[model samples]
Structure formats: C-alpha cells, structure tokens
Target: MILRRKENLSKVEQKHEKLKTSNMKWTTILLFLCFMGITMASAQQKTFKGTWLYEQGEKNGTIQLDLYQKSVENEFDMDGALCFGTFAFSDGSYYSIEEVEVEGNKASLQQVLDTEMGNFKMQMTYNSADQSIELSTNGANGLPDKLLLRKSDIQNQETSAESPIINEVDNETSSPINWTSIIGAVILIIAMAGYSLFIINKKNEFDQVYTTEYFSATRRSNGKSPQSSSEEDTQVTGLLDKLQHELTTFQNHTSGASYLVVLKKKQHKKCAGYLRQAIEIASTNPEILHDLQQYAHILANSQKRLFDGSYSVMIAAGIATLLVGYLMSDLLIVILFAGAIAVYYLASFAPQYLILNKVANSSHTSTGFLGTLANIVGNAKVITYIFDTQDTIDTITGDNIYRYDDYSQVQASVFIVILAYLVTGIGIMYIACWRFFRNFIMH
Candidate 1:
C-alpha cells in the first residue's frame, strides 16, 4: 500500500511540472508578440521631404511637400501631424500651400487657392520612390482634372551644371517678387488708359461744339432775320444741328466703337452749297460779300478737316512701333511713339502754318505778321526753340508770367502734356518688365 501511494505522489508532481512548462511557453510567446507590435508601430511612422513637378496641358507647376513628425503619436500616424507644402506655377506668378496627410510611401494632400478665375481645390497623392505626384480633382473649369508630376531635382541639377554663373547671379540679385512694383505698374497702366480715353473724348466734344462767332456768322449770312426756335435758323445751322443729331444717334447705336462716321463729305458739300446760296442772297455791300465769301470758304475747309483719319493712323503706327520695338529690342519704337504724339498734338496748327507761310512767301510779304507767325509755328526747329525758351522763362520767372504768350503757352502745354504721358507709360512698362521679369532679362 505505501509503494502505491508514493507512485501516485510522483505522478502528481510530473503533472504539475508539465503545467508550469506550458505557462512559461505561453508567457514567452505573448512577450514576443508584444515586442513585435511595438516595433511595427514605430516602423509605421514616416517622413517625406522633396519638391515635385506637375504638368497638365499648359498648366504645369511645382510643389514642395515636406512632412515632419510632431510627436510620438504623430510619428506613428503622419495624418495627425502638420505637413508643409507649396504649389507654384511655372511663371512663379501665384503660389499657395496647406497642411497634408501622409501614410506609408504615399501622401494625400488637400488645399484651396483663390485665383483670378475662381476658387480652386487641389487634391494630390505623392509617391516617394519615383519622386512623383498625381493631382486629381473633380471637373472644375480652368482647373486641371488630372496631373502627373515628376521631381524637379533632376531637371534643376542639369540646369545648375550647365549655367552655374547665371544661377549664381539669379540667386544673388533675384529675390522674391516685388508685390509693390507689380501693383503700382497695373494701377498706373489702368490710370493711363482711362486718362487717354478721357482726352480723346474731350477732343471729340470740342470738335462738336460750335463757337459763338460761328453762330453769329451763320445768322448774318442768311437773308432772313434771326427768328425764334420755330423759324428755320439758317441752312448752316440746320445742317450742323442735323449732323449733331446724327452723331448722337450713331453714338447711341455704336457706343463702344472706336470711330463713327456721322457726316460724310457729300453732306458737308450740300451744306456748303446752301451756305453759298444764302451768302449770295444776303450780299448787300462789298465788305459784307467779301466777309460772306471768306466765311463760306472757311466752312468748306472746316468740313473737309472734320474727320481727319490721319491722326488715327499716326497713333496706331506709334503704338504698333512701340510693341514691335519691345519685341525686337529696339529703342527706336519709343522715339517713334513720342514723335507721333508730338505730331498729333500739333496737327491742327501745322497744316495751317504751312499753307499760310507758303502763300505769304509767294505774295512777297514773308516778313509780315502772318508770315512771321507761320514761320514760327510751321518750322519744327522754331517750335522747339519756342518750347525751350518758354521752359527757360518758366524756370527763371517761377510764378511771374514773363516771355510766354497765350500761343506759346498753348503749344508748350500741349507738348509737355504729351511728353509727360509718354514718360508715364514708359515708366509703368519699365517697372513691370524690370520687377516681374528681372531674372529672364538678366540671364
């Protein structure tokens, strides 16, 4: 009986030992699994930093995406942290950035930018191995639907090796864009355009307005006494009124057009014929007849001069020359524009001066008042001299009016205003080209 009992005890001890061994094995496995879980969690955290290029049609751009760990928690999950990124067009005109999310070898980012077209929402995914990104978005007009981007580093590396000196210069001189200059240039351009249109409209208004002397002459030419509104004013007055009405009608119809022809030479010739008949009927004395004839001749000439398309051609040529000059790298375009403006401003006086001077010289009275005035006005050199003298007088006398007469003031003022306009236009363009495209120009 004692032997049987001892054997049972030994059997029980073996069973206990077996149970202990099983518990130890389970503990080791659990510890191993826990260690593996912690390692995997640490390994899951990642950071990516690089520049990426994207192209879709004409809309190609660069994006700099950099993801940095914020904390242990964020280290494990990049989406919980901040990722800095910037997107810029090829021209470097507009740029924007926003926080992004990263996981494994891919990162998903979302950003919104306010542009001239409208608001744009950008969604992108990046692959670290290829240094590429896929930009995807829903159908948004003016915004890319899908874009593929490769790293710019490779391209930049090739460029840097080829043009180290140019790159160095760019780095030293070309900093970030000058926002002030850009804004100023745009504002100046708008202001210049508005002012130029205003000037042109003012000139048109002047051309349409008849002087008091002209109305008096018209009334005198007609045989009938000047009557109230109901009575027919005069043939000249009626024709002018008709012309004015037609102009208003044309203006109303083609308000945005550059030029409108309301009265043709045929209409003006009819007016002249009516005026001549009226003058013949009203001719009572030799002096009155002579005055009436002179008035008729002036009316005919004025009608012929009303719509001088030469000025338009000159202006168009000047502007075209300026644009072509800029493209061709010639300063002659600037000179051409300046000269054209000068000619346009002095156009009214020039033809009169030339004709009057020629008549006076032929009549052998070239030294008389009319001859002297014509010579002074017609000769470009004499005009330049007068302008210079007036400028000198202005500088020396300050506020006190001295050598400059009404005629001189008119001429000088016109020239100076045109010059100022040209200078201002050039200055605006210079600021735009220099500030915005400095790198392109310098390199």
Candidate 2:
C-alpha cells in the first residue's frame, strides 16, 4: 500500500512538469509573433528615399526630375522646381505625400510626380529589386512609363567599391549645359502667362453676357409699366388700397406668414446696426429671446456676405496674378498669384455658394410668434451651418475656392485655350535663344 501511494505522487509530479513545459512553448510563440508584428510595422514606416529621374514622352525631350525620401516621413525635391515637406505611410493601403495630402492604396510614387504637371493625372508602381519607379495614367490606352534609378545612384556613399562616387578630380568638367533647354523653359513660362491673360479677358466678356442675359430675361418676364404717371398713379392708388385691405386680412388670417416677414424685416434692421442698445436691453428684459436670436442670425449672415464678397475680390486678384506669371514666365509670380487666388475663393466663394443653396432649400421649423421670429432670424444660420458642415473647411478657406468665381473660372478656361499660342511663343523664344547661345555666344 505504501509503494502504490509513492508511485501515484511521482505521476502527479510528472503531469505538472508537462503542463509547465507546454505553457512555456506557447509563451515563446506569442513573444515571437509580437516581435514580428512590430518589425513589419517599422519596415512599412521606412520612407522611399533617393534621387529619381522624371522622364515623359521621348527621352530626348524635356524631362522633369525629382528627389524622394529613401524611406517614409522625409523631405523631397522636385527638379529645382519645388521642395515638398515630410511625408509618411499611415497604413499598408495609403500614404501621405506631405503631412497634409493623403493617398490611398491605388497611390504610387509616379502619381505623386505627375501632380506637378498640372495637366495629367498619373499613377505609379515601385520596383524594389531594380530600384526603379514606373508611371501610368488611368483609363484606356494607359501604357506604363518606366523610370529607373539604381540604389547606388542615390544612396549614401560607403567606403566600398559598390558605393556611389562623386569625383571632384575634373573641376572644369561640364556638359555644355544645353542653352536650348534653358531657352525652352523660359519660353514655356512666357507662353503660360500669355494664355492666362487671354483667359481673364474672355472671362470678363462671358460674365458680362451672362449677367446681361439674366437681367434681361427677368425683366422681360415682368410686364412693362405704363409711361404716364397721372394714369399710373390713379391705378396704383386703387391697387394700394386693395393691397392695404388684403394685408389687414392677411395679418388677421395668416398671422404666421405675416409675423415671419415682420420678424425677418426686424432682423434685417438689426443687421444694419441701427438698433439702440437701450431698446435691445428692454426687449431682452421682456423675454423677447426670439428677436435677439433673429438679430444675431441676421448679423452673422451679413458678416458672412461681407467676408464672401471680399474673398471673391481677392481670388479675382490672384487669377490676375496667375495670368501675369504665365505671360512673364516668372514662376515666383505665378505661384504667388495662384496661391492668393486659391485662398480667397476657398475661404469666401465656395462657402457662400453652399450657404445660399442651403438657405434656399431649408424649411423653417420654429412655430408661434417666437418660432416664426426665430425662423426668420435663422435663415442665415441655416446657410452658415451648411458651410460649417463641409468636409474641408481649409479647402473651403484655401486658394482653390477662388477657382469657383465666374471671372476666375472663365479666365482659367480661356488661359487653357490660349496656352497653345503661349507654347508657340515659347518655341520661338527657345529657337532664338538656341541660335544666340549656340552660334554666337559659344563662338
């Protein structure tokens, strides 16, 4: 009996040891999994950095160049044209080009560069093995354009034969720095400016026509008034008497509508800032909260209108600047103007349009005298709310908003049309510069 008890205890000890071993194995596996997940996330965070060649169309023609981050969250340079801020890969599906601009899974390296063209939208694919970036546009007939750069071409120099070398041995070594290329670039700039100017002129014409047509159509819909004042006055007096009677009837029967209109007029009067503070205080004491709400709404709306109009004007100025830049081939000028135009329109024009639409469509919900007063006062509130609800307040406040202006939009359209002419001008300038530099200056 003693031997059997000892044997049973030994078996129990063995079972506990076995369980402990199993637990350890599982713990090891869980740790390994955690490590792998962390490593993967870190690797993904690595920026794609290097100098890249931007080739479009034939290789012999003008080509753009760019410098990108070796990994994620770094700065990049665009062929002496533009330098972008830091970028990052937020998830496996998308990345941010700069801290602000985000792109989805369909986003690739080449698409980023194509944004500079300001004309065509493109996509990109990266090749890790060859260290190359390829681009393609969307839609039918989309052919991939391959741009290759070896890791050695852009990576940090190592103290080994495989590392990229920058030789300063030949101080005078130069590649004739193509005068034709410089000339071409200059001409292109000029042409763009000229085209922009043309667009502005065209936009003015279109706006004039549109405004005239709108007013004419409206006037025609309303019958003309009689020329004789004496005859008209007699008819008008009778109509006025009838109107007075009807208004009295409306005040009694349709108090809601009449109250609403009166409330609206009062709100407008308050917006004009003619209301005495003492009167406002008395009204407030009487618990005329509806009147106060209406006043506030009107004031807010008026402020918005003022801001929108000012912004529209600013956008117009920016468009004008863009036109000037296109004509002058001054990149700095163009960028400044374009930027201003974008900011004004985004801030004022776009929000106003949205607000106007909302106000026109939205229905009043408030009832009774106070409700009707609130409804009347809240007309502007509805519009302002719509503006606030937009997905991009910055975009609404940014330079892109100026693009919505009739004049600006028209000008931009015209600029595009006149771009061909500008291009021609640039070509001529290029040829002249090429001849002067190659034939005369070189000799």
| Candidate number with greatest TM-score | 1
Residue 374 C-alpha lDDT in model 2: 38
Q: Give the alpha carbon lDDT tens digit for every residue of 22-97 in model 1.
A: 5643443344344335434533433344557777667677655543321111122226432244456765434333
Local distance difference test, per candidate? Answer: 0.40, 0.33
Backbone clash pairs for candidate 1 read none
TM-score to true structure, per model: 0.24, 0.21
Q: Model 2: per-residue lDDT, tens digit, 1-443?
A: 45346546755975776575456434433443443454354335323334344334453111122122212222234342222212122121111232111131222423333223222344545566575545454531233344333333544321122110121112111111222223333443343333223222222111111122332333233333212234433443343233223221113233454322112333333433332231112221122323434433433343232122233234345445545555555564455345434323332322222333334455642243234333444442211112233244466555322222234444554555345333432233232223222211221
lDDT of 1: 0.40
Winner by lDDT: 1
Candidate 1: Cα lDDT at 184: 37
List candidate 1 stretches off by more than 4 Å: 1-49, 55-60, 67-83, 93-122, 126-131, 139-141, 152-443
Q: How many clashes in each structure?
A: 0, 26
